[model samples]
Structure formats: structure tokens, C-alpha cells
Target: MPESWNYLMDMDGVLVHEEHPIPGASEFVAELTGNDIKFLVLTNNSIYTPRDLRARLARTGLDMPETAIWTSALATAKFLDSQRPNGSAFVIGEAGLTTALHEIGYVLTDRDPDYVVLGETRTYSFTAITKAIRLVEEGAKFIATNPDATGPSREGSLPATGAVAALIARATGREPYFVGKPNPLMMRSALRALGTHSANTLMIGDRMDTDIRAGLEAGLQTILVLSGISADSTAEMYPFRPTRVINSIADLVGNSAAPF
Candidate 1:
């Protein structure tokens, strides 16, 4: 195995910001390939398939192989598969969440669902929330893809997957099975895919509450990069701290040297 440290990365801030690539982000990713660093893209976004993500990255010249990317959707699917219980789920997110659950063998449903899965559902209504609550009361498991309070938007920000989950929980008086960062489930899946010892790996992301927390949960070193959402001011007052803080991935590794 390569003695160079392995890296687990979160998308969005750590990589491309929205549709456009962050400055030097493409070259930064290329450096990973150049160094045989054994890095994997582990994103909390439950939106795209591995293939889709790979293609998206390719547009920016990252060209990550399908196997190197693991989204929260895939992790959730794997988690459901491990349980091996057959049940239908009522999902509140878009095509990504639904496609992921179906790919994972979860039977997505609206009538008499075995579980009510919630995410960033823009079309949510009181009726849908009521039905989901009723299903939960009927002894169905309640799952949330992630508890992100807000999602990044060009207009500033909007409600994240967690906010929708909170609505369902409040209406039903029950909690949700959150499956994203800070939950440990997603981190475990990432480590398994990378085939690396957790202790030797570094988790790099822009969020302190989720990404860094998940790294700590998975027993890996953590680094915070300011290229995306996290701010230096927040880190100074954060309850949890990363092992290192840098301006961007460009600072540590460039297209110049082998992985350290």
C-alpha cells in the first residue's frame, strides 16, 4: 500500500462551488492522481449517481473514476442493504433521493410506507407532512438523508435537508434516522470504499459541524479548508477543531510534488 496519507473529501465547498469549479480546484484534484494519494470524493449531497458525479467532475477536468466517488445517497443505500429488511419508503426529496433508495432496493411508496424519508423537499405541503407523520405513527422508521439546516444557494441560502426532516419530526413527535455527516454511517462507508486505515486518512471539508465531526467519529485526522463555506472566525470559536487549517487545497499539494 502507498505510505502517503489517504484523503476523504467533501464536495461543494472543498471542491467545486455550485456548478463552477473553485479556483485551482481542478488542478488540486489532478495532483491527487499524480501523487497516488488514494483520495476519494465523499460528498453529503444525496443528489447524483456515482456516474453522474464523475461526469460532472470531468467537465472541470477532474475525471474521477466512478468507483472513487461515494455520495450520501449511496451510503444510505448501503446502510439499508446491510439491514436486509424489505420495506417501502415515502421520500420527500427530488429524483436523486428516490433514485438512490430504489437503487439500494428500498421500495419507495406513498401509500402505507414502511418508512418516511425526508430531505430538501421544495414541494412539501401540510398534507404530505401529515401523511408521513401518520405512517411514522403506524410504526414506520423515519429516516433523513442529512441534517443540514440550510443549503447553499446563489441567492445566499435556503432550507437544507435537515430543516425538512425537522418539520416531519415536529409533526409526528418522533425523531429521524439522519444518515449524513456527523452521523458516522456515511464516514464508515467512505472508509470501506477507500480501503484505507482510518487513522492514516485525512478528512478535508468546509463544514466544521458535519465534515470535521464525521472525521473525528471515524477516527481520522481532519483538515479545514477555507475555499468554501467554513469561515476562520467560526473555527476559532468551534467546539470541535480540525488538525490543520489552510486557505485551500492548493496550499498543501499542487501539481508539482508527490503525495506526502
Candidate 2:
């Protein structure tokens, strides 16, 4: 409800569901841009770049610029760059993760690299997982983009980065450092990207576990919308709570000029 509050919003449930634009979502985004409100669409899905996501969102009737989008891939790449500039990694992911690392000047190699970067992929290969485990055993630091065990798909749930990371961890006895949501590092990274202070930023998400927890840990106000995974009753089970609960982002649209 702060007048100066900037926003970091989740993408899937807040704006769209199953690649379909949610009702009032387009209006909400327009209101933000029309007022020149600073906000970023944050997501843990690391399979696509900002450009790719922007195009996809457009197809769903939500037009957003690439600069207003942030992904786990970008966060992971930034984290790695900070840890070791020009580092090499054995990456297991698609263009999103690979392109991020490449743009950051990281070499993708399998020959005893500095890290084993794991990320979301539609088709996770057993061969790649094997190589990742072997690399971890060879002393390469293990890092995963996010801790999401299951990803939504038309065919039901599919194994995500966290699930694969668990398999690698069990094999090599090395726990991966998750670089995405639920880790305050990702939130802080997004804040840095938006040039916003945590105290003056609002983290809006539907999931209480990842989004709300990440925002709380990063010292930002949190909003849990019922349009996604979390419900009103679900918040009671968590020790921490969102600062506000809304039916959807549409609620924020009409009040864009006013304090949330």
C-alpha cells in the first residue's frame, strides 16, 4: 500500500494460465506501463529468454517489453558471473540458460569446468544427468537454476531442475546451490536489475512457498493472489504471510494510480 512501491510479479498464474491470458491481466499491465510504474515480470521458468517470453506473452494478449522481464536464467548467470568471472560450466538446459551464460562470457564445456549448471528443460536427458553427476564427482561446483521439482505440462507433471538436482545430489553427495526463487539471492538480483530498494518494492506472486517466502526473506512486501497455486487457507499453514491477498492482479489495475 506504499505509494512508492515498485513491483516484482510472477508470470504464470498472475497474468496467464496455461498460456492463456487471465481476465483483467492485460488491463493491469497497461495500467502499470501507462503510469510509468516500475515493475518486472519475474519467473522461475528458465527455458526461454526475455525476448522469447515477451513474444509468447504477446500471443496471450499481454504486450510487455523485454526489459520488463526477468527470468531464473538471468539470475543464475549473474550469480555465476559474480562468483567467477569468465568461468566455464557444463550446462544442461536450453537456449535460455545457455544464452545467458554465453552472454556473460561463460564457456560451455564438459571437460572439468568450474561448475555444473542445471536448469529447466522440456526434455531432460538421462545421459546429461549422468554427465552432470560425474562432473560433480570430479569436483565441479553444482548449481541449479531453481528448486521446482515438478513442472506443469499438458501431459501432467514433468521432472524439473530440482528433481534432477536431487538425483545428481544423491549420486554425488554434493548438494546444488539453487539460484532461483525461494532463494533471496534471486529476489535481490531482480531488485538490482530494476534499480529498486527492497523496502519500496512489492513482490506479487501466487505461490506462498517460493514467491512469498523469497520476498519476505529479501525484505520486501509480499502479495499472494488466489489466481494461482495458493489459496486463502494455504497461507495459514506457512509461518510467514503475504502483506496482502487479492483475487488476482486485476484488483491492482483499478488502484494503479492509488496506493496498493
Candidate 3:
């Protein structure tokens, strides 16, 4: 049976939790694959490319194809590609981000750029921050993968790419043009890839603030899996709630029944 959803799911909490597989996530994803459901791992973490994400998932026992995943790194690259013919970008991010952007033919230059892209900077140096801000204030377009305040790791969570982006935004008196979840651009690109719109789609995520909000804003039904960031207790504070909430993806019995 064709599900009401042509799905787009988040990878971090919904599938793998900080370098490990969340129990039952594989079952949930298997259900979709068994049913011939079209889905993509739409994640805002630019720390890893699609291939890297797949590799990580494979280590944790879920072997998803690279084509079935999409990362903010790739989206940011594609976004800049459209914005500038031969755009030069100033990237204050990790190696994964710069690598993805470069693959798409962006000139990653610090001296002159048409855009300033920000992500989780492993080396969040004062020099790097200052240079990014100067470039933005000097008329370069400011873009960020997502506005996450912290990065999720097995050690817990740390100040995220959004924190880095915030400093530059503060310095320039301009907000970043966000490209990841909670922003419509990510969903727009996912829809284009799926060749379907919201009505036939469902979004599965872990964070209500970012993942759920992004799907809701993009007009897709939302599912929250509590294996990652947004725990059940934390969900109560949200202004809006997910369409369904499940303990794990494996708890899902069938397409007709819901766990909420």
C-alpha cells in the first residue's frame, strides 16, 4: 500500500543517536523500504556529507544509500551555486562543509567572496570569527546551515553551528539566511528530489524546535521519535505538537495505526 506520505526523515535522533543506532530505528526505516516508501535523511548537520552519514549508519547496522540522504553541506553548496555564477565563499566551518562546497565548484577563498557560509567550526578561533564578520559586513551574503545552538555528540551536546553563526550575525547586524531544517529551503530541495509535495509526505525527526517545526512550516505531517534530542518531558513546552510521537520507530505496528 502507498503510504499517505512520501517521507523525508531526519537522521540524528530519529535514526542514529550520536554515532550509534537508536534501537528500532532500523525497523521503522525497514518498514518504509518494505513498503516502497520514498524517503530521504534530511539533516541540517553539515559536519558530515551524505556519504559520510551513510557510512556512519552502516557501522551502526543501518545501510542506507548515499542517494537516500541529504545534508546541509550539500544544500548550502547547491544554494550558493544558484546564487552566484562563480561565487567565492568564505566558510567558517568543518572540513566536511568546505569539502562539500568545493565539490559543487565553489571557490573557497577568505580574501574575496560573494557569500559567507557558517557551520560548526571545530577551530572556533577569534581570527576566524572576526574575518567572517568582516566579510559579511563588507556586503557578502550571510548563510548558515541551520540555527542550532549546539551540536549533538555522544558526550552530550555542545555549542553548535548556530552559535558560531550568531557571533557573525551579531557583529554585522544581520541574521543568517538559514538553509537547514526549520527553514523552507531544505524541504523545498527535498520536495524537488522526491518530485512530490507535502500532502503525500511525512517528516520524522527528533527535535521539535528544528525538525518538527521545519516540517510543519513546509506543510508535511510530523513524527517525533524520542531517541535523540527531544525527550518526552521536553516536548510539553512546545507551542505546537507533533502529529505523532513514538518511543522508537520499531513500536510502529502498521501504517494504519499511530503511536501518538
Candidate 4:
């Protein structure tokens, strides 16, 4: 609740709703930028790079710089690079995941890779899943960008990386190491990127299951905003609770004088 706390915020719910900018979201971002507060917009979606996400947010009237964005793809890539530098992977994902791995000098191949990496994709291919299963069965490590079972879409919720990872796990009897939200590793990576300590960092998220859990696990203060997936009533069901709850990010807009 301190005024000097750095922020780590979720993208979809805390900043914008779907493709639209949440009310007062831009002002909140502007306040942070103007004050030179270190912050990062976090997302479990591994489909787009930070640059792509920045442009998308720009269209929603929020001018978030690429440096302020962090996706699961980047976190996963960093994890892999640290765990096994220049390792090979059989990737089942899109440009974001692939590009991150490539940037870290990972070889994307099906020829006995060190890991079979799974990430969110618009169209998950059965052929690819079959190949992934085979690779895992043959002793390749399994890794997933996130544990989200479903992803938001215009039509409705679509099966996400976790669901697909479940399928592959069932087939090969190997569980995937999920590297995104709900995992403290992602928060640690984001914190390192922000160059901030957890004690003075605030994590604003909408979901108790992933964002809040991750923040708490990473030793950061968490705030649950009601503008996203979870409601106040739902908070009681969770054994763990966020440090604070707010109606929306709009409430925090120029009111940094008050403890958030």
C-alpha cells in the first residue's frame, strides 16, 4: 500500500477488457510512466510478442511500451535458457513462443529435442499433439507456457495450452512443467526484469487462481480488481486471499495519495 511500491499488473482484466481499454486505465499507466515507476504488464498468453501486444494495447488507447510488457513466452524462454543453454525443443506454439526461444539460441526441431514445449496457439493441430506425445514418450522433457485450461475468444472460451498439455500427458504419461501464472518462476522473472524487490512490489490482477496466487507465492503484495474474471463473492472460496481488493483500476487513477 506504500506510494513507492512498484507494480506488476495483469493485462487483460486490470488494464483492458478484451479489445477495449478499461476506464481510467490509460491515466493509471500515464501516472506510472510520468512518475517513472517501474512496472510491467504481465500476461499468460504466449501468442504475441511484447511488440505485438504493445500495438494491440495502443489500438485500445493505452500506449504501453514494449518494455512494460511481459508474456509467458518470454518467461518460458528465459527459464529454458537458464536451465539448459542452447538446448533443442520441439515446439507446439506460434510466433511469440518460437521467437523467444530463437532469440535465446534454442533449436526448434523434432529430431530428439531436449524438450517438447507447448504454448497457446489459435489452431492446435492434432498432428502436432501426436508428434509431441511421441517425442515425450521417447524421453523428451515436457514444458508448457501456462496451466490455463481455457482461453478467451470472440466466440467463447477455447481449450488452451493446459488442456492440450493434459491430453499429451495422458498419452505419454508425462506431466508438463507449466512455466507461467500460478508459478512463482514467472513472477521472479518479471521482478528481475523490473529490477525491483518483492517487498516493495504490488501485483494487481483479476484472478485468484493464477495472478493472485503467483504474486503471493512470489512474496509480493496482491490486489484483486473486480473488473475481470473473479468477483468479490468468489474471493471467500479461496483459502488464500489477495492483500487487497478494489472495484477496478479506475479507482487508483490519480489517487496515488491514498494507500492502494
Predict model 3's lDDT versus the native.
0.80
Superposition error at 260 for model 3 (Å): 9.4
Each candidate: RMSD: 2.4, 1.0, 2.4, 1.0
Output the better candidate (1/4) by TM-score: 4
Q: Candidate 3: lDDT of 209?
A: 88
On a 0 to 100 scale, what is the lDDT of residue 228 in model 1?
Answer: 84
Q: Per-residue lDDT for 171 in model 1?
A: 77
lDDT of 3 at 172: 87
The digit string of per-residue lDDT tens for model 3 on 1-260 reads 23356778888777777677887777767777787777888888888777777888888989778989888887777788777766788888886689878887888898878888888655678888899888888888899988888875567768888887777777889899988878878887888877888877788888898888988998888888887778888789998989888876666636522333
Candidate 2 ranges beyond 4 A from true positions:
257-259
lDDT of 1 by residue, 1-260 (tens): 23567888988888787877777777777777877778888877776778888888888767778888887777777777777556688877776677878876788888877778776555667787788888998888898888888877778877777887787788778999888898888988888888888867888888898998999888888889998878999888777789888888777655223233
Write model 2 residue lDDT over 1-260, tens digit each, in one string.
Answer: 46756889999999999999989899989988988889999999999999999999999999989999999999999999999999999999999999999999999999999999999999889999999999999899999999999999898999999999999999999999999999999999999999989978989999999999999999998889999999999999998889989999888877865545
User: Weakest 10 consecutive residues, lDDT, candidate 3?
Assistant: 251-260
Number of clashing residue pairs in every model? Answer: 0, 0, 2, 0
Worst lDDT run of 10 residues, candidate 2, spans: 251-260
Instruction: Give the whole-model CA lDDT for all candidates, comma-separated.
Output: 0.79, 0.93, 0.80, 0.93
User: Tens digits of per-residue lDDT for model 4 on 167-224?
Assistant: 9999888899999999999999999999998988989999999999999999998999
Q: Give the least accurate 10-residue stretch of model 4, judged by summed lDDT.
A: 251-260
Clashes of 2: 0
